[model samples]
Target: MVQTVQSADGTTIAYEQAGSGAPLVIVGGALNNRQSAAALVPPLAGDFTVITYDRRGRGDSTDTPPYAVDREIEDLRALADAAGGPVHLYGHSSGAILCLEAAAAGVSVRKIAVYEPPYFTHHVRDEPWEVFANKVKTLADTGHGDQAVEAFMRHAGVRFDERVKQEPWWPAVVALAPTLHYDLTLEADGVVPEERFGSITAPVLALYGDASPDWAVASAAAVATSVKDGHQGVIPGHGHDVPPEALVPFLIGFFHE
Candidate 1:
């Protein structure tokens, strides 16, 4: 069944519950809602009461302007609390950053699986990110959601002619470009605070694709090193877009252990 919860800041966060065992929350990558992880949930439902939610300003969730990463973390915490206590958490891409931050903030995450958070070091420049953020905000403000989405794809290293043309969610992501800038801004300002990963006491499992960018691999390793009981793994034959089926078994085994 689907359920809705009003965050402390009045945004309506929507979530779906399935399966029948220990509660587990799945947070999707940037520009994706709960449905993005659909493939993994059904199989997992057999052994877990999986919870999937629309991050703020997407899907059925309401958008509150002046977005803060803390607000997003709170939404996750609210869902976790509702699920009982100390539930397992999993997040992909930016969602990984959120899950890590939530765990560090004393959210009672029993175990966490993070998939390729894009935390770059000083070697990486923020100029491109800033430029992209501005362009996206302008496009979204000017009613050019399509263009904004295109801008986002370019920033995320998604090829122009391939996935964008064939994937069904491409257009939908473009339609929600207005929220894309907020997502970018949250990450740029270090809202997730990469330096604070050491504070997370929960056992963390960090996953990265063998074909992912060098910076992504480095970031995942850095996070794994910071956590007290963190482990890192590489998904073979996958890039940043790791397949759900490929990851489900890993997650089930880790969380169940």
Candidate 2:
């Protein structure tokens, strides 16, 4: 069953938890909700309490007016408060960017681990954010949500053809089209803010798959080197979709240490 927590802005954030011991929150990337992190729970559940919540505006969570990344940090703060003190965070893709932001903003983070934060510093985007944002906004605002989702997916290198559209989960993914701007905003210009990262006091672990794109690998390295106390690791023989077997060990080792 889902539980609720009230963020600073009074938005009701929905979440579920498993296991026991210290709190560990898993923040998923764009188009993902609380359910999206379910695959990771089983393995890590044995070592820590796993909390997976829907980012506001998706799943059972409610959204407030004029979304800001700070509000999302407040949502994380609420989760941390509910966890009963400082909490560990593990973020993937754009979610990792949010984690870095939260930690830098002085959220009570004990430690943080991120996987491929999607910072394209090494390989810049072809078009400016305004152009892409307008296209997605227009598509989503005009009731062409499917097209909006497709545009974001294509930009993210996801295969969104007819076969994918026929899947049952496609509609849920499309429904999250409005939040694409949230992720895009987090990634503004695709440059990694090294100065902001320098402010984070928590130990940071940046991981990228060996088989992932060169830019992703470089981004992880840049993140690790930028922070005061950061480490980078490679998940060998893996790509963006890292399997639980390969990922859990690294997480356990890092979070436990």
Candidate 3:
């Protein structure tokens, strides 16, 4: 069912709630909306009241002026309250970064299960991200929205099938590409502040794909140390866009444990 909740800053956050049992909020990474998570939902929904939503400025959610990371955390807190409080957070890509950030910022969380947050320690450089962000911003500012999406995806190293260029969802990516700034800003040079990560006290299950970049394992392992009870999981044949089957066992074991 479609529902709305007022974020701490009064922005209206929209979400779709399905299935039953414990509440689990699925936070998608860049360019992801509820539709992008449809395949994983059925499996998780069997054991959870799975909630998938559009982050602000994407899909059905509203955006507030003067964006800040704190505001997004407030958005998640609002959804958790709406979902009966202290909900589980299942985050993908940069959404996992937001999940960790939210828990560190003191949002009520029961558990966090994240897949391949883009936190890099060794295999990435700091300078290119700034350059990339500028190019994307310029294209978006000059109204080349579709080009902006392509540029962002390319810079992020996503190899989409050529068929996607002709799909109906291509337009959605074009529309949401501007939010890349929000996602990139959350990375903060691909490393969060020590105190900030040190504050994550929740039990975290961090996952990474074997087929992802060489830094994926290193990044995941580093993030595991940030949380009090964090652990790492591996998917043998997946990348940043992990196959749902590769993640099923981890989700079931962690959430049901």
Query: Highest TM-score: which candidate?
Result: 2
Clashes of each: 0, 0, 0
Which candidate comes out best when scored by lDDT?
2
lDDT of 3 by residue, 1-257 (tens): 77888898888888998899999999888888778898888989889999988888887788997778999999999998888878899998889999999999888898999988887767556457788777777888788988888877776787856677799878878888778878887866777456777877778998999899977787788888877788999988888878888787798899888
The RMSD of every model to the true structure, in order and in angstroms, is 2.2, 1.0, 1.7
Question: What local lDDT does model 2 show for residue 195?
Answer: 93
Residue pairs with clashing backbones, model 3: none
- Score residue 146 of candidate 2 by CA lDDT: 92
Error of 1 at 160 (Å): 1.0
| lDDT per residue as tens, model 1, 1-257 | 67998887988999999989889999887788878888888889998999999898898999787888788888888898889878999998888888888888788789999998877663355466678678889999999888887767777777877546568866787766787876676567432354677888899999998898887778778888889898998888889888878888889889988
Candidate 3, which ten residues in sequence have the lowest lDDT sum?
Answer: 120-129
Better of 2 and 3 by TM-score: 2
Winner on lDDT between 1 and 2 is 2
Score residue 167 of candidate 3 by CA lDDT.
Answer: 94
